[model samples]
Target: MTSSGIARPAGGAARAVTRTLSDDPLGGTVRRTVLPSGLRVLTEAIPAMRSVSFGIWVAVGSRDETGPQAGAAHFLEHLLFKGTNKRGALEISSEIEAVGGETNAFTTKEYTCYYARVLDEDLPLAIDVMCDLVADSVLAAPDVETERGVILEEIAMHDDEPGDEVHDLFARAVYGDHPLGRLISGTEETVTPMTRRQIQSFYRRRYTAPQIVIAAAGNLDHAAVVKLVRQALRGTPLDTDPAAPAPHRSATPAVRTRPAATVVEPKETEQAHVILGCPGIDRLDERRFALGVLNNVLGGGMSSRLFQEIREQRGLAYSVYSYASQYADSGLFAVYAGCAPGKVDEVLDLTRAELARVAATGITEAELARGKGMSKGSFVLGLEDTGSRMSRLAKGELLYGNLMPVDELLARVDAVTLDDVNALAADLLGRPMSLAVVGPFDESAFAAR
Candidate 1:
């Protein structure tokens, strides 16, 4: 039941089996052990480093929620820190900070993670605190109500920032009423009416052992981590067969949907923010490496086509970039820009022209080399922190079902040829565009253009 390429021994006592994922000199050794409880534990040993990052990842998020449970996943993230059976909210923060450590959690569209980083010597404390919070949170009625207002204010704060709000508007324009289109922090309408019982029910249903992974990196031993985790989760009854790893795909396959459209939100702002994009490839698509290369050259940085053309050449925008978001079944490729309200049309036109040009002729050889170099540099630099390593292991296990070596990932990026980028550009960029704009103008402002 383990992922492909990992060997699992047959018929053993309720224990963990370990396997090495990577032994790179630069990144250290990554090992994975699937606990009998179906909770996969992954760790990377970097003896040279003094800090360790521990994370508990759940494979459920806002997209897994029903309409009535819109913000339950994010809401529970807040409640988990309020108090566990043995520790109060203030105690939780004090314990971590007492050791000069940091603890936090974030909920995304597809998953949620609670993590802590501390000196390697204090790894045991970090693991115990995080596991206690995850396993034994007391979702008190008062705490739930207090957090509800906090979440509502978070929503209002996000609303005030049009630059940030426009991306949600873009997702709505592209995905329509689908779960992917909804905000991670459910709207005021959804959160205001949510009850404690509903939030607790959502937590019990989604926070099961089979859907969780524990990841650690930096100055650690595989066996020691497994022992600590086993002791930490000793009393909790895990609903899993002791003999097998959890099934990889538990939930039904996500429905893929894409609709080309435009959504404009009129607001009084100093500048107009717009996103021009279209549907893109999913996480498992083999062509993603090519897409990454294309994205880098197109709008990934200051030297990218969008940035150079819009900001450096034309001075139409102060900030402009392109990014791609990939999920289990669907994805999005977008170019975003913030400009003077009067320059919206020109910005859109120029952005469209760049897209068309790249789609038709593809990028130059110089662009291809530069894109690969940038991708490689960023990839390596990003993993220098223990937190990034822990994140990479958790995501690889939960999403890809295997941990790909750092060199292997770079090879995939390097293998992307000019033809690959060109072909991807011709296909992905040639699709119809969905535009989202947030400014003080009506739809009529863009109708004639």
Candidate 2:
């Protein structure tokens, strides 16, 4: 829906290449137009394939939920499919399936998206159906009552999984009371109180045309897609503009209390699930590429420090990995491991030791080069899928404000020197780490280093 503020493009070499200026033709080829009512349209043509994927991204999520309205965005996503003016849930499913296509939707902290993939000839129908779901979901009384229980059960299910609990724990320690840490599904107390009127008010106030972004990929023509979007969203009342989000302030470092007083089950699960992390870079940070390379060396793949030490050498756990999940303004760099109940201490010690080792000594050239190769390879591999390509485009729109070509991304990875990776590790993972362990382990094990 807007320009993807992607960096300059690069050459066709599989290895990362530095660029003088971007060689991207897609920058010029991408077209943007706005309707009288405030709907923004963005289009690009991918001539290599015969299929088309039309996406509608709305800028409201659980983070946008006001007091007592948590999980409203996710609940609203389910209700959208239950019924609309033109079709009921069953009919909608049958219609899309008859044409050998598929439809789905997802909810996140910043957006809700409904997308469909179909043959190019069915692009108009796909657009119509998606727009209807967004602008016209019938939050019927019975459906609301029905979905409340479903969401409640979903919340309960997450509570039973140690990995899931530790994730929430890490978010709580990092974000404190900020909306960024709020659970998407919400608690029973908050979601049970939601009413049909509340859902309607939120939908009307936030789902405006100006805040909606439609991204399509595949063999669709640019002009035809522009026409289809313009026609489908013509009559909806685009009467409101979203209020600007609050400025983000980094959360003060906190040592969280364990789940001792709160009710929790799964105390006897065989493997312990640990989510140890620290606050890292934001999505818009220029050094995000360096952080990516750092993560790869630490625990990103099979050869990573955490994996090789915890799993391969000691045989303490079946799975161990490190990752970074960056959002609009901040991010989390974490190490997750599933270990034998008796070996939780060993796994935790190894993880912390590896983090400290990297911070103190930094990485060698071989480690940096290998990490760069892995990061660049993963980037290229992700581009092969149509859904991933569409997702990458949407991420660029929402984050950097432009779609970064694969070539440019590779170059950035290539440019990350050993010094860059070491600096990032020292900046992010070198401090006292926030710990979240979910299992039959004692909190004393996490007493600060």
- Which numbered prediction scores highest in TM-score against the true structure? 1
Candidate 2 — which residues are off by over 4 angstroms? 1-29, 239-266, 442-449
Give lDDT: candidate 2, residue 89.
82
lDDT of 1 by residue, 1-449 (tens): 23522334575456566788788877888888877767889999999899999999998889888887888899999999999888999999999999999999999988999999999999999998999999878899999999999999999999999999999999998887788899999999999999998988888888888789999999999899988988888786443556444444432465555667878999999999999999888898899999989999999998999998999999999999999998888889999999999998899999999999999999999999999999999999999999999999999888877777888889999999999999999999999999999999888777754
**Candidate 1 clash pair list:** none
TM-scores across all candidates? 0.96, 0.87
TM-score of 2: 0.87
Give per-residue CA lDDT, model 2, range 1-449, as digits (tens): 23222222365222111111222443324454444344545555567767777788777787788758888898888888888777788877777788898999999887888888888788888888887777777778998988888888888998887777777767776776677777888788888898999988888887876567677777766667777776676565542332222222223332232221212223667778877787777777788888888888889899988888888888888889988877766677889898887787778778888898898889889989889999888887876645665666555554455566666778888888888888878878775567666777566545533
Best by lDDT: 1
